[model samples]
Target: MSEAKMNPMHELSDNVAVPFEQARAMPPSVYTSTEFLEQELDKVFRQDWLCAGRSSSLPNPGDYTTMEIAGEPIMVLRDRDGSLRAQSNVCRHRMSTLLEGRGTVKSIVCPYHAWTYNLDGSLRGAPAMMHNTAFCKSEISLPTIRCEDWKGWIMVALNPDATPVGEGLAEVDALIGHYGMENYVESFCETHRWNTNWKVLAENFMESYHLPVCHAGTIGGTVDLEKMTCPEGRPAFNYHWILKDNTMPLTLAHPNNTHLVGDDRNKTYLLSIYPALLITLTPGYFWYLSLQPDGPDHVNILFGGGLAPEFRDDPEAATHFKALKTLLDEVNDEDRGCTEKVYRGLCAKSAEPGLLSHLERPNFDFARYLNAKIQGEG
Candidate 1:
């Protein structure tokens, strides 16, 4: 299918024929399709520049970590020259698995045949293979993946022809420049496996409609849901929802956080970048959520958040951070519950695609974005 046929933005707009005050909801297939999920993994996750981990995780040379993207194991390591590199974790010879988990390794050796690769993914040695006539050491380097570090986040792209991370994120860079993310330290990180499809989680993160009912105790009281707005006309790669609370002004009184006074103090900005990255930039801290699909109906949600480095030394700041973490945890649990229920509903024979609400432009934009990419439109 052509991109234009798949992403009829004008048709989408006309079909929903209502003012912003009366927008409908998205179709339910977005939450339920196993086939659709597979296409997303190929077109969106595999093709887009995804936020994988923070540069701080590999602070020293030889530090390395492994993660899966679109079911492919990816190895990311800091080389001897202190440069970060990402490569497919499969050995060039016999396709053996090379590494697992995070650690400091001078070189990665494939357990199957002991083929060793340097941190830069170059073939360091293949002990017994040097004697073989057909073996070529120079031609056996592990396949390298594209990687870029921006504001402490390490992003990787699996597609060799994919757009550069800098170009894809140029707008986000400008939007979040004031957050000073480089000065932030990751203090909390956790992951949870869900029995729901990945799209459910992505859709949940893209819209704020459920906040008033679902997160009533945690963040609903603080967010001005009625004032929420989403990015329009641009690529559906980014979405933003703002929450302003009155207590935000007093929050600046906390030590080392005077910089977030007045208009900036109480606002919470939630942004979902296409397929699997979700970032929440708050007054004194930020949250990064990475979603990875495990199967047709399962997903891994990795969560990380922390206070800016300037506030890291204060005991009072730690207490505040803990409270915020607890609140976020509660809200996440609420989402998990809903996603599972939605998953069950999607499996029903009577299930049909739904509508899009005007307030759900973020969610609609995300669906449109997915359609474009899957159809090679975007």
Candidate 2:
């Protein structure tokens, strides 16, 4: 393709070159173009360390969860030795998918051919393969993908040389280490497909400017927008803060908590780990969305959250979680409407970029990150 045809986002490169105060939303093509989405699949999603879910989700041997990243079926499982492992979910024989959704199993058995494999992904049994001289059970094993239990998140990378998740997020750990995020128990996780570009949802999470209006029925009134801070982002991530003083006890520092004090006790962090792990970390609870592009027009989300250790065993823990989940679902519903509308507007020929607000500094940073990755500058 010619240079003009290859570069879909005329606005993206320009947005990255200017100062944050002068930045604007990415051009509509950034969200509507099929070509641009393919480029992202190759350069961003395929090469980045993608979060699968929380490590605690698969606690015992044989427990597992499955997800697709950049069109590759991946399964993260707890091996027999009590280690987290990721491998191709596709069966070697007949190329069938070995697993579906999340569950525990003694071993991987291909539903197509009844071919059996151990928890480690090594082939154990294959029927009627003796006639084939090339069949080697010893050599037939599911391809191993790079997997890491970074803090508590299960991260996997398709690119063998991708930066280690821990090293990439070292600064993040330093920023929120006192919260002991790794120990937070994940109470629920569910998958949903949304009709909006992944970037729209990501950018929404990066700012609080729309919270009061967009989340009016849920957390809108609870947020003090003036107290929020949107600073310039780092190479691997962007972050902002919301100082909350709310009725939700799980969002504030628990009585048993000693790590945070004063304003930090009610502080909430909105962290966007490029290319798509968005975390909402609080003193008492945490939630996150791990995103993947279904196409230019849709995104697949793994949404999950739970309480900090201090609140998990409280007598009212169950009730608190139920309320939290209810609130979250409402918030998500509001977000879905907003983002989908934005996408619909983008798809129109008259769509144009708009200037960013100070609260959208993280959104601007995210644009720069996408520009760098797709242009091979990162």
Q: In terms of lDDT, which candidate is strongest?
A: 2
Against the true structure, whose TM-score is highest?
2
Shift in Å, residue 351, candidate 2: 0.7
User: For each candidate, how many residue pairs have backbone atoms clashing (under 3 Å)?
Assistant: 10, 0
Model 1 CA lDDT for position 69: 90
Clashing pairs in 2: none
Estimate, for each residue in 207-318, the C-alpha lDDT of model 2 and write its tens digit: 9999999998878877887888888899999999988877777789988888888888999999999999999999888989999998899999999999988888788899
Q: What is the Å distance of residue 191 in model 1 from its true position? A: 2.9
Over 115-203, each residue of candidate 1 has an lDDT whose tens digit, in order, gives: 89878788988877656898887777888899888778888888888777778777877776676776777777777899988877887
Q: How does each model score on TM-score?
A: 0.87, 0.97
